[model samples]
Target: MILRTEIATILKAPPIGETVTVMGWVRAWRGNRFMVLNDGSSAETLQVVVDGEQFDEETIRGIGFHAAVSVTGELVESQGAGQAVEVIAKELTILGKTDLSTYPLQPKRQTMEFLRENGQFRMRTNTFSSVFRLRHAVAFAINKYFNDRGFYYLHTPIITGNDAEGAGEMFRVTTFEPDSAPRDEAGAVDYGQDFFGKGTHLTVSGQLQAEIGALALGKVYTFGPTFRAENSNTSRHLAEFWMIEPEIAFADIDNDMDLAEDFCKYLITYCLENYLSDLEYLDARIVEAEKNLPKDKRRPMGLLEMLRFVVEDDFARITYTEAIDLIMRSKPYKKGRFEFPVSWGVDLQAEHERWLVEKHFKKPVIVRDYPKDIKAFYMRLNDDDKTVAAMDVLFPYIGEVIGGSQREEREDVLRQRMQEMGVHEEELAWYLQLRTFGGAPHAGFGLGFERMVQFITGMGNIRDVIPFPRAPRLADF
Candidate 1:
């Protein structure tokens, strides 16, 4: 009978002199005597001392890189330098053997692009293993932070009729064949005969549906997958991604900003307190990766230092107009180094946003009160009539981690905004009815879950943080 003890548990508190059984894939087989094993329980691996004389020639030959095996061994203090304890194998069984010649992954360092191609075995690598472990930690921290703050987790529909962002870049959900679909008298595709009886898509944002929950339950959040059909092949864009939207009733823009700051700090703080070892591994990985880069191209701060600074320091708050002013006066803008033009009504590009957070403020920033023309219709109209009560939380590496605003609670104002923006009022009758009936002043924001993970793990590409990435021309298991 084999009752295998996890490598993480045995490593945490070594049961010296006790004979135990451990099962895992061999990480390394150094000198054919030291077998390092890991079972995905933690980032750390346990070393198994396998005496070639004790094991049969076949068993010793099977122990190679990433070979699955079971070993019953006596735990003892290590004679090596890295780890504190080691296991002296009494019995060894080869469960699965790997042929290194055909294996895609090698013991030596591999490029991230190659690792992404071989995602089936990427998590076995230390870099990806640490990245995914922290991804899980950040996700767990998201729920804990919301649940502890009395926010209800609302599961919004993945397929929805409304375009919350009015971007019109959504993946259509339909069963009809593209060439042969029902047509109306005017020769247009008739969506009325579709499965849902109307056109629907994978939702781009869940904030609108979550608003209903907030109006009824006080504070609610939606943490689920959303999709966009845009053809953006950038490090920041994703075809399918997760979002965290928290809506609160009776809250203004100021209250929303305060919640955003506190909630972000809480998540970072939780990961720092609980998953420090994994973070340290990732931090060292970044340092090694950036060693060949020029001084100007390298990151200003290390991964752990940047995370701690974000949590400890206060995020600078300013209006959209103020941010524009700062960018216009920046050295990059004056020297014609900025790629995109900066102005009042124009939306802030990544370059402009990076300058504000990295050069001007030197910290995270919360820029509020964007122009009404560039923002969504749901944002409340400011008293000035030119801007809306919208806000975006910008971070050091990532430009915007969170974007939210005070929603338009007034029925007439919402109607006017919708009309001006060309949003059909008939489709959103239920949404309007909420305001007409019992809607109160409410505000909310959405944080891209992968972007947060990328920031924490210091992974260069957003696709690296997600397990199975969905992007333009790239969809693999």
Candidate 2:
């Protein structure tokens, strides 16, 4: 039996003169002698040199771009200038032949839009592969960062009855026919006949359930898929995406802030050290992509520099009021250049967040103590009765990367807040009971995993980072 070797491993430590079997799709072929093969193992490709005279003529002719092939080769030091090692093909077998005439991907530059249209096959591209590799590294780093700190990886439910964010953007799950479901006395659609015996939806966030895990297990984190049904067609919004939510028991808002900052820094540092090659490639891509943009729109720091800065520098910590004051006094707002209104009570828009992180701070900023009305009801109420102990970690290009708060532990306060926010107290009885019992001060935050990848990979569109993005009217395979 022949041993299969990945292209990455062969390229890393080429076993000179050792026979190995390499299997992957052909990326490119030149003069039927040199073929670049990629197996999605690493961002790099293996240069397979074949002797056509020794191999079957049909096999040599079958080799084409995107054709899956098995190449039995001897690893040898490369004579080529671009790579260090190349494989000398002893025998070649075409496993799958892809017709280039109908293939969506070509051996040329492709726009993000075109790549997204062919998302089913986009992972084969160097850019998407690099982005996904970095994404994997970031996720692994997240688990390691938590696991090293004695945090249990919790798997929360994907479907739930509670509106975690109270945003009312949940995707409804029902068994009844739409517009033809049984109606009650009030002429409202009867939910009792539904599959779950009540209204259910795809979860918006796992933080609420993660709190249960934290209460029972002390510290827990959830990395899972979440859904939102908002019809947003932007570079940032996604109908479905993964979220990393960590809940810590007996921790206050300050502790949450500390944990959030440390977590962000750890992820950035992990990628910088582990995925530097992919990062370097992405950095160059970002620089080249921004070259056509306006002078003022281009980022001041490259991808690696930005990641290093996040790891080295401390995140600027400020209160929401402080940020509002800065925004109001800034040139954009003063000169009426800001598109969104920047009042003290109004929620911070993307424009306001960018100015705070990109222009004013020039670093990641953790803005806490937002106005109570503008934030979720579960956030702990401050003594002033005006603001909640909520925090948002804003990034340079991405506005809000993480959002969390110190949950209200007191049953009376929690119930009152729920009532004021029009959340049904009966439906969340189990959740509210946590406060009724020995509910200690708990804090947690939800980090948009896709957005983090976007920031890390220097990719502008959120759709490019996720494997298959679910967005408004765009669920292409």
Candidate 3:
């Protein structure tokens, strides 16, 4: 039996000599004679030339869009690129069929908004199939790039009593029922009586625990789902998102940035070279809506150049004070400029980040030395005592792609900061002990997996790239 081959492979080999069997869905049907079937292998469709003589009326009339089928036919060379090879099917087997009466996906274009509503069947669409394949390739490429560099892949705990990032955005996953839950003398829902004998919440970031293993192993990376309860419904925000964090012991902020740039460039280059076919589909069909693209934005740049550009590129390193000064010098009462209001010692918003990276510097910019009040407590305090050694890498399209900082290695400083922030010291003994016993000047960054997708594919929204997004008012699928 001729096992089914990918359409891309068949397209590459021009002279189709033997009979081939392709299994996929009926993408479109024209008249009673011609039909196009997408084999879920590639963006290109197979010309399923059905004949009434050999096939029954039920077989011919039963097929519809997204209907799974197996086709065996003789391969013939074609005169076009996407339509390169033509499969003249001799026997067609129906595998599975979707009820077209209720099926929302037609042989037409779908907006990203509409597609979000029907995520289950969205993978069957041309654009999403390409997006999904490229996403898979990029994720695998991330693992490959890190693993090849002798990095330990670590899995951190999800439910934790300590908040790692200190963002106060953790989702409480408790078993305490509101109706019949054990209460304290104060009549409040007694979290102490809950599971684990204490109140536990889903982890907001795995950086802290992952740092422990990194300290022991010298280098480690974690790829896992991190939950946040920030109530943010934006183009780039997700309630639950995958974070790729690599913590390196004995590494400073500069070393951490180098690794970040190298990792980002590797992911991009891996996709451009290995997943070119999938990327082409995403660029050709999805983002541009199959429109003809310009030359500069045609394909992504080479990997090494991308990496070098990120590191050696004109990186404008400005302190938080300097950034605030720049914002203050800008239009006092401006019209059609500076979307978000910015002031000194204020946390930068998404629009401000976009301005700094997308418009001001027009390249990947790293803004460091943020005020201690606005930065995390674990970040090392500078000699100035006002600003912490924290940094955020803001790219052009996607703002704040990577966030890292030199950790507070001093035990006294860490305890002081934790005390100032009113953190539950009893719960963070293990973490604080890392500082006491040979904790080097370590650093790491959390790269949002969806933001990486946005950077690679040029997809605008986070919802578009993820298979199943867990947002505020979504997730029926």
State every prediction's TM-score relative to the real structure. 0.98, 0.95, 0.89
Q: What is the C-alpha lDDT profile of model 1 across 1-477, one tens digit per residue?
A: 658999888977889999989999888877778988888888898899998788877878867788889999899999989999989999988899888899998878999899989999999888888888889998999999889989999999999999999999999999899999989999998999999999999999999999999999999999999999989988888899999999999999999999999999998998899888889999999899899999988887899999997998899999999999998988899999999998889999977888888888888999999999999999999999999999999988778899999999999999999999999999999999989999799999999999999999998899899999999998876
Best by TM-score: 1
* C-alpha lDDT of all candidate models, in order: 0.92, 0.89, 0.79
Clashes of each: 0, 0, 0
lDDT, model 2: 0.89
| lDDT pick, better of 2 and 3 | 2
lDDT of 3 by residue, 67-117 (tens): 888888888875545566687888888899767788898867788888888
- lDDT of each residue in 1-477, candidate 2, tens digit only: 856888878777788889989999888876678999999888788888988688877878777678899988788888978888888988888889887788888878889899898888888888989999999999999999999999999999998999988989899999898868999999998899888899999999888889999999999999999999999999999999999999999999999999999999999988888778789988998888889999888886788887886788789999999999999999989899998887889899888998998889988899999999988889999999999999999887678899999999988998889999999999999999898888899999999999899999989889889998999888877
Q: What RMSD, rounded to one decimal, does every model reach?
A: 1.3, 1.9, 3.8
For model 2, which pairs clash?
none
Give residue 339's error in model 3 in angstroms.
Answer: 2.0
* Predicted structure 3, TM vs. truth: 0.89
